[model samples]
Target: MSRIYRHPTQPTVELPPVDLLTLLFDSEHSLAQDDTILHQEAANPSNTVNKRQLRDLVERIAHGLRTNYGIGAQGPNKDVVTVISYGQMLVSAAFFGVIAAGGVYSAASPSSTVAEPARQVKIGNSRLLICGKEHQAVTTRAAEECGLPLSSVLLLESSPEWKLRSLEGGIDVVSSSRLSWQTITDRQALKDSLITILWSSGTTGLPKGVMLSHENLVAETYITALSGRQWAAKEIEKGNELPAVQYRTLGHLPISHIAGLFGYLLAPMYSGGSVVWMRKYNWEDMLKCLKQYEITAFYTVPSIFLRISKSPEVTDHFKHLVGASTGAAPMDGKLQMAANAKLGSGQDAMIGQTWGLSETTGAITMMPKGESDTTGSISPILPSVELRMVDDDFNDVESGQEGELLVRSPLVTNGYYNNPQATKDAFHDGWFCTGDIGSLRDGKFYIVDRKKELLKYKGLQVAPAEIENVLFTHPQIKEAAVVGVPAPDDPGTDWPRAYVVPVGPDAVSEDDVKAWVADRLAPYKQLRGGVMFVDGELPKNAIGKFLRRELRDRAKREMGIKAKL
Candidate 1:
């Protein structure tokens, strides 16, 4: 049973067409009719695309899926195996196929820590496990540990030994047979069934996978295209018949991350746009690709922009880009201003930023381009999204007052994978708890902080647990507790601090440790608060939870003592 929450104020925006796939195809068709093919295909789009051919391509994928994956089939009562659980490539394919089949593909972040697997599994309500070869071991280990059987697991990796075996069997047989993504059909997803499993940031405890249907992703993508009107204006100004937005996106964000998967891959490709991918982060290579591809739109974290602004080569090469969209992390106003200056005068890129979570499909509030002081202002709620700010008593706050942001949207996940208690807590009455502290002023959303004790620097959100996980990755570190300490009189709200128990005398120094983290994480999450070597264990709560509050208070006391001395 699905619950619908009517907003205190009804949505005033025009409802977008429900058939998003049709719109994308039509839009492409319109582009073709007007001879507005992107720069690459300006000469001859006969090699590029035609609407009927594109639709046929989709049909082919659907046909392949039905034949290969046993879609719309009646089997011998044996639980059929589909690999939508693991192998990011399969997950991505599943997402598209599901959309094509009118099913939703759940959004699951691959970077979730080990402690979060069971919670994600339960929240997702997904029984079938789909994964590629590289992630099979980890996925299998977690699924089995969570009591999911071997029959439920589906392997999509290509191994020479198992080339001839069929994929419709138990886990062992499938593993032995080695199924490649190429073998799977592209359009076999069940439309009405749950397609996606979006999860919360999972900064505090376990991550809950939110269930999303095919309709949800399509709906959101359609609205996103409509909401960004300034980009449309740019295209009109350029004398193009339709908006000249190309689908060239930088695909550096993890496939599991919503921004990476949907925003960069699905949305653009659905619009007949192509994306440039990076297996790993290479700043220079990215700039080179942008210039080489003449990427018109840029989607990434603010930290990425900051890095590019600092890199002379990026500015030199990517000056032709007309629009840029930043999300996944908050962009500093100073940085935003700097970026605009670096890009120079000839091309005024429509720089925009947005705020969202995995549970909301992708974006809820976006600061559209041409808006001033747009750094932290996570613009108006989308047509489908409703926002409410409540105080201690759960009463709505006055216009200027601050409160916890409760969001309700069709884009909201069905619930946490399997954790009913967590789900109940997350979805109260009708609104889903964003767990983010924010304030709405004149319809603009400004995030204050997170309900959980996670630290965010720049645009890259830093989960304290992820940092702790990284700490344990070190050979000499025994126990570690990472916490956010509020930066005093600083522009950004918080800075991350880590307390670690060392196993030996010659452990890495604070600078060495910070440098180590810098190499892994984006620039904003650098451990600038300085590492402290603790003698024993960190202070804990009754249930063995690290009392981060105590650490925060201790830091304050130390600062006060230093001032007194």
Candidate 2:
């Protein structure tokens, strides 16, 4: 029997059938028109975009894309536009513009190599490529490699002036041309409409594109926002003076991921807040911006919080921060409490931990406002999200017993793009298998283990199979298995380590292997955990499958982590 768990406190609300773009700009839930929605962290007055201006820009870019590139000419969700760019205010424009033009927005990391973006382009069947000025060279190369025309590659610029022009000088986004987005109200259409594609490495294999729909985005945004509003209302009723939490956050993380996509782009618009765009992440600059912009709320990963807890540079910078949450990886309880102490100016500014994946469209569990849990739990099950902890046989585990966590929610992604088998494997009956082992106790959820082997480095997904495939390309490497070893300094993050069996003894050094990987893969996917050369064949099962658990346990033992694998 299925023992599905629902939020004990929060009531589930019926979600309205509406598209994401219309909900953000046209619907009753839209922000105030005159308010600033996007801000520059560099303190440039001209670099900001208000809600009114943003709407207009979205329309103009949409029109330009449709007119020049024929994006969305065949209808929505058919044309995929790939964007690989640094964090900037105009990136939001490109995102909405693509969606508004009826194109599926596909995000690729700016740190990605030529081959990575090329592969994504091929997989997505991308009609056009959009990138920032900084990544123009790589984007151009990827576009060429993928057989995409140079005219189809658009350069999104924000420094001297806001412009979206083609690298080959054929297309230009003009302010006069405006194309209104279709306001979708049909429930089935909303559920099926693919707006974005965020990549994720499931339990195994290379990165697959997680297809998110309008329904997924709308449900997630509404449910998350409703949770906060309810908590604020209760605080008001209790006659407790609530600290004003103006939803201003720094966009320092990669917008390619779901965390940055929802937190920076979608959430701020719904909350009538501003997102200060940081061109790229820099520790010192981030701290300075936090104090300078008086940032009130932000969502980040545990690695950043780890730095905040131990870094001497962190002082009153987080004073104005009233709301903060961490996700993408597990956070230590001690580090969470320590980081909380530096926030809210002696008020209740707890660093809540969220639990979810790109497949769930960001977070499935979020700690409500004015609440603090120091037990390392991922708060309660989010409203409208049903969770089930089950054993290997698909039978429900006993209450409070840890098992593989499966979720059923409107926020969950439809499936992986262009991959039917993967999509089928991702679900069990109607539930989306989370691949995370966790338990529900006293209405709070705690992640005990990961069923999946994907490595997270500073909130970015790094597939071990992708790294292993790169390693296999080397003639000197015979048999290679990649596993995530916990980073010594940074909590809640892992480094991709390779255990290799050489073709010949002493044929390749560790530095040679590391250098080889660094040249091929992205910076984050490099073997920062160091490569280990095995004497013979790796531990394997009777079927000749690699015993990743045993190697993972060995890796943990070497790292001084006493936790059982």
Candidate 3:
């Protein structure tokens, strides 16, 4: 029998007969009264954009894309617009506008090196690149490398030397003579359109693009919104400081990242919540904003939750929180309970955790609100979502037996954008094969380990292949292997460890290798687990493949004594 864990409170309401772009703009007047988008400026982040302004901006940008770039203007085949910027009003406008004008939109992380952006643009077939002023140089280089016209690049702000180009202003001017597009009433058209291309760092090798139709996104949005509303009802029933639960959410998560994009940004907006976006994450600034805005909800990872659980100031600040929902890595139930207690969970505030993949379009399983026992039991399969625990042979596992999870839902992605072989291999009988190993006990899903080789370091997915590729960039490195071992200090977090074989006598030291990697990769991808200079060839099997498990075990024996970075 196929097991399905449905949410108790999630209602099956009639879905709107429109696309995501239409849904955002077609809000109730009462809900749209307050500012929708907020970002940090300094100690006080008062910068905000209301719903009306967001709608107008989308219209302007859509018109500009159509008029200037002939993208998403009026065509059956929509062009792709790649956005490389921080989370802000402009980034939101650029993205929504592309979809409004019928263009495919993809957002790339600014922290990523040229290779990542290049691959996204080339594979996504993006026509125009929209970048922020700070990242103009890298964006320009990436665009040139990808053979995208420099003229197609639009900067978020105007500059002097590089010629300031305002994407907002240019679009406003172009669309001045044209009326903004009305809501697309055609439900079937909206369902069929490919609105976004979200990339995933696959289990091995380069990141693969995941194409999502507007319907796929809409389904998740509607389902997630119902859950949020139910949570608000629970908060009200339990007695909240703000009287009833208000859906004011924080958006410090990266706009380009899947967790940030749907879990924090779009999903909250869909639920009639205002998102306070931070340009970049700063612990102190985040602490200030949480209190200043009287934020009702938080979607974050366990590492930050652990930090908050320790801080009295942060704890005192979030007294009115409805809940803190965490994912991306393992969360300690005790730590979550402690954090919730501080956030006035005594008043019935909730703390939660979920398990998901980019292939499933954010989380497929969620921990029920008001629950203190995390225990990796993401409450249910959610409405219309089905789960099955299967062994390596794809046979169903017995109760309490660990097996890889297979997910089937309307929100499940169609497939990877360009990789048919991968798509074909990952799915069976309508279920998307989730590489996570877990068991279904009672009704809730309990995760144990992942069958895939992808590493999770502090809630961020760190692919060993990506780190090894960067290691190969070093001249002194001959053979390189990377693995994720438990961080010595942090109980649940994992740290990326590098094991290297030197090519010459003048080879780099451990610190040198770490520093080089730090410079090249993101801070989270750093070799905090310490780099070991291995002698002779690295551990391998008969097929001559580098054995990461041997290196991982060696890491525990050698570098496990080091203090937390």
Candidate 4:
């Protein structure tokens, strides 16, 4: 039997039973009680980011959205602002700006293409698109393609490209009203709906927009703040209490990811803590920041941990770093042990694991601090979250049996934006199907495998089909199958491994193929894991569909690759 937790809201904290709703606010009474704790964080004197500043920023933005653009509460002022905040206060201000103006704020990964910005705008049915001027042209083109008038596009920063003279005198579309981002960040709440369109990583297929309301965001953030006190309590009880200590974190994950946006950004700030920024991932830079800032907590994916383990300087700076949390992708048990041992117990640093998706704002389950051997397990379900295991037929699965993970909670997204068919297929009754296969053991959750073939590189999802399709565009490639190979840097995360069958003898060099794909895809989606050649057609099951399991096994046999999982 799974462990039954003692918390008031979370009693039956069994596998698939504990969801965000059950963990955070299962009842009105629990919410009322927890609200006190949340308010305490809000009122903490040590808060690095003040609520008044936040409030002023929001009110200012609301006023700007209304006055500068003539967008009133009931007017047709539904513009969507897309941005990537690298753990900066700007993200919070932008979020508030959207809510204050009754507009939707869509998140875009900084790595996303200049052409894809329209996904969020079109999904939200937005009239205007706002972005930094460097990003404005791409946003403008994408919005234009989506049928959004270019007149509705607003650039936060001005560029020579934005000047109408660059495009042969007069511009075809009326320019959107210009206002300082500084000015727009001051308006207070206008009771406009709060919506943020989060794109799924598309491990399953094309990304869909997960719609979250203001109430959903506030509820999740408040609960996360309330529950975060448990961290301090766990730390002190583990015998590392200090009178003058402060909480700080290194935030490198994209603001577009739920784990980075909600868990690392909003939750920490809401708890009177501060976050350090790294625009992108760089192992040496991360170590330097840890040593320089004496960063207490770090949030990241498993691939980074692997790089750190391989680094010789990791041990020296490991002592200064406090708690570390890894999520978004699975980490190998051996790598987890290595990371844990690097940060000795005396330093009060705990290597924790958090499980989450785009739907739940981030973190459905957080490993208890000081616990040992959380290698493959995702710990217990969080305070108010709920989970369930369902068989292939949708019936409940028994404990210790692998099955699809279904989640139901107030924190789960209301549904996919404007896609009722997707919404219907994604949920059974009310449970959101995670499409991940896993099992429970001793009250903890462990992912056995994915029911679908999606690759995770340091927690970012990469669809094999997408890469294969991209590869097929090459003239020499006749057949292609992409599979994830356990990375040597870290056994925890998977690397995109491609197997290619060429049309002619020695038709393409590996470098040639890699260069071709690199030109078209982002850095993370590159075929850096190496490409292998095959003489015959790819092994397939009885059906015509490629059997990824067979490809993985055959690759392991042929390449002598072994997994630490």
Q: Give the winner by lDDT.
A: 2
Q: Give per-residue lDDT, candidate 1, residue 363.
A: 84
- Model 1 per-residue lDDT tens digits across residues 1-565: 2322222343634433344454444544223332322112211212333334334434443344444444333321122223323222223334444345433344444443334554455544444555555545666776776787755555643222222122345323222122112111122231233545555454355456655544556656766765445466786798967744565665566666677667544566455565555444456666666677676667776545654554455455656576676766545454566566655352453566677777777787765444545445666566667777786567777766667778776666666555678778877678887777666666556665565665657544666655664565555665567777667667665688888777667677887788778887777776777688888667642213356767777777866876799
In model 3, which range of ten residues has the least summed lDDT? 157-166
lDDT order of candidates, best first? 2, 3, 4, 1
Query: For candidate 4, lDDT tens digit of each residue in 458-501?
Result: 78766675576567556677667788887778766778888888
RMSD of 3: 10.6
Q: Mark the regions of model 3 whose C-alpha exceeds 4 Å error after superposition.
A: 1-14, 27-46, 74-77, 157-174, 182-188, 202-204, 228-242, 311-315, 345-349, 368-373, 454-565
lDDT at 420 for candidate 2? 95
Query: What are the lDDT scores of the predictions, listed in order?
Result: 0.55, 0.82, 0.68, 0.59
Q: Count the backbone clashes (under 3 Å) in each candidate.
A: 28, 0, 1, 32
Candidate 2 lDDT by residue in tens digits, 128-208: 999999889999999889888898899898777888998896568745779999999999999988999988732245679
Q: TM-score winner among the candidates?
A: 2
Candidate 4's displacement at residue 129, Å, is 2.2
Tell me the tens digit of each residue's lDDT in model 3 across 184-232: 6576776666778777643245667777877777777776655555766
Q: Evaluate model 2: give its lDDT.
A: 0.82
Candidate 3 TM-score over all chains jointly: 0.74
TM-score of each: 0.64, 0.80, 0.74, 0.66
The ten-residue window of minimal lDDT in model 4 covers 36-45
Model 2, TM vs. native: 0.80
By TM-score: ranked, best first: 2, 3, 4, 1
